[model samples]
Target: MLGGKTPSEFMKLPIEERENILRGYLVTDDDVQIEEGDDFGLFNKEIATGSLLQQEYFMGEDEAGKQLVKEARQIYYRENTFSVRSHWLCEFICDTLADGKPIPIESLVQRIIVRVDVEDIYDMDDDMVDFMPEGEKEKSWVVRDLRQLLEFTNAEFIRIEVSGRGALDGSDPQTQEKIKEISGIVKTLIEQFGEKLTIRKLTQLNDGQSIFHDLRSWLMLE
Candidate 1:
C-alpha cells in the first residue's frame, strides 16, 4: 500500500504527477484489471479480494471477440458440427463467414450442427423492453445477430439443434412445452430461409449432453 501519506499529499502534487501516482496505485490495487479503469477500486486489499470471489473475470471486448474465431475453428477446421451455448455464438459464426473471414482448414465443412439452448431460442422483439429506461431502446442483438445470421454462411447444410430443459420424448410436461416452442422457432427459420437450416437432433444442456455434444466432437471416426 502507498500508505496514508499519498492521500494526504495528493493535492500538493502537479496534475501530471498526481495522474502518475494514481496510475501507480491502480497498478498495485487492480487485481482484476482487464485494461483501463472499468470500475477500478480504491478499497482495502482484503475487502477487494473477498469481493472478487463473487465476481466474474473480466475480458476486454477485443479479447472476448477472439473467442468467436477460436470457436469457428473448433467447428469448421475439421468436423462441421458446432454446438452453441449462447445464441450469440451462432450469430458470431454467421458474421465471420459473411464478412469473408474464412476459417482455416484442409477439408470442406459441408454440414454444420449449430446447437442453441432451448431457453435461449426466440425471434427477437423490436419494442423496448419494459425493464429498460425510457428513451434508451437498444435493439436486441438477436435481431441483428442470430436472426440475420442464417441468411448467409459457408456451409451447405446447417442444422440448428435446440438443447437443454428437457428432451422431446421426456415425461416432463414443462420440458416438452419448451421443446415444442423451440420446434416452432426453428420451423420459422427454415420456412423463411429455406432448407439450409434444419434441426436433426435435440440434446440436453446438462452434464451428459455436454460430454456427448461438446466433449469429443460427437465421439465419431469422421
Candidate 2:
C-alpha cells in the first residue's frame, strides 16, 4: 500500500515509474510482506525491468496481447512446479509407457507436486532414480521406457531442471564439493534424451520473464 497503490496497480505503471515505487515499497517497511503466488512475487525482477510486461503486452491489454499471455501461461510452469521441488514426480508424468501407477493430473487445478527432499544416505532405503538410460526400474529407461524423457513428445525444445540445494547441504551423494553435480544430472538428461532437451534455471522470482520466452534467441536463456 505504499503510495496508496496495490501491487496490481503498480504493475500497470511504466517500468521506469514502477521501479522507483518498488524501491520504496521494499525498503520503507521492515514488516512489508511480499505477496506470494501473486504476479508481483513471482516476477519481481522481470516486472520491475519491464521484461515481463513487454512480453504480456502490458498485461494483455489487447486481443493480440492476450494470446501471448495465454501461450506463456500454458507452456511456462514456475520453477517449483517441476524438478526443483519434486524431481521424482517427473518420472510419473513421462510420455513413455512405464510400470508406475498413473498420476491423476486430469483437472486443470490439480498439479502433481511430490517433494522428495530427503538427505541422501548410502543406506539400503535410499531411492536413487536416474534419467541416464539405465536399467533400474525406479530410474528412467531410454526410448521404450520413457519415450519423451529424451525424444520430443511434440515440442521442438525441452528443458529439464533440478535443484542444487541438496548438493550444497553436504548430503551423502551431493557433498559440498559436488555442488556442480546437479549440472551433470541436467546434462545427462538432455544428452541421454532428445538432443533438444535443454534445461535452464529460470525463476518465479516464480513467473519471471525467463520462465517463458518465444524462443526469440537461445543466447538469452543463459
Candidate 3:
C-alpha cells in the first residue's frame, strides 16, 4: 500500500490508475552526491531535473501555476527565470483595467503581447504541445494572441502602448488620475524587478503635455 491500499491491491488496478499513483509519489533527487571526476552523474542529474520540470509545467492547471513551473524550468535550462515575475505584472495590469469594466479575452491577450516577450514560433522538433497549424505541417503558434505564451517564453520586458483615441489629455482630470495610477503600478514593478524587467510606454498622442506623454516620461525617469 502506498497511500491507503496495499501494494498487492494497487497492483491489481488498471494501468492508468497505477501510472497516476506512481506519478503522484514520484520523487527525484534534489541534492545528488557526486564523487570526484564523476561529471557524467552531474550531467544526468541536470537532464533528469529538466524532464521533471517539463512534466510539472504540462500538468499545471492554470496560467499562474504553469508560469511558476516554467520559471523553474527556465532556471534549470540556465535561461532567464523572470517569466513568472512578468506574468504577475500582466495580472496586475489586468486587475487595474478590470476595476473599470470587465476585460475581454481578446483585449487581455493583446495586453499580454504588449507586455511580455513571447516565443511566437517553434520548430516541430520542439518538445512543446498544443501548437497551431502553419502552412504544411503544424508548428508552434505565434505568441502574439495566446496567453499561454507566458508559460513558454522568457517574458521579462513589458511594453505598453496608450492610444490617443480616447481623452488622454490633462483636461480630463479623472482620466489623468487613472493614468497616474497606472503609471505608479509600472514604476513599482520596475523598482521590484530592477534589471530583471524593462518596462516601456508607447503613445500615439502628439501632445507633449498629455497624460500619455507624462506616463512615458515617468517610466523613463525610473
RMSD of each: 16.1, 14.4, 18.2
Identify the candidate with maximal lDDT.
1
TM-score of each: 0.36, 0.26, 0.24
lDDT of 1 at 10: 35
Backbone clash pairs for candidate 1 read none
lDDT of each: 0.39, 0.33, 0.35
Off by over 4 Å in 2: 1-85, 88-134, 137-148, 151-153, 163-185, 192-195, 202-222
lDDT of 3: 0.35
Kindly list the per-residue Cα lDDT of model 3 for residues 68-172, writing each as its tens digit.
333333333332121222223333233111123322221122212232221112224544443434532323222222233333233343344333333433224
Worst 10 residues of 3 by lDDT: 104-113
Better of 2 and 3 by lDDT: 3
lDDT of 2 by residue, 22-120 (tens): 343222222211232433435343323322422443444555444433333333221112222333334434311111324222121111222222233
Q: Candidate 1 residues 111-153, lDDT tens each?
A: 4455555455354465536555776333443332344334444
Candidate 1 steric clashes: 0
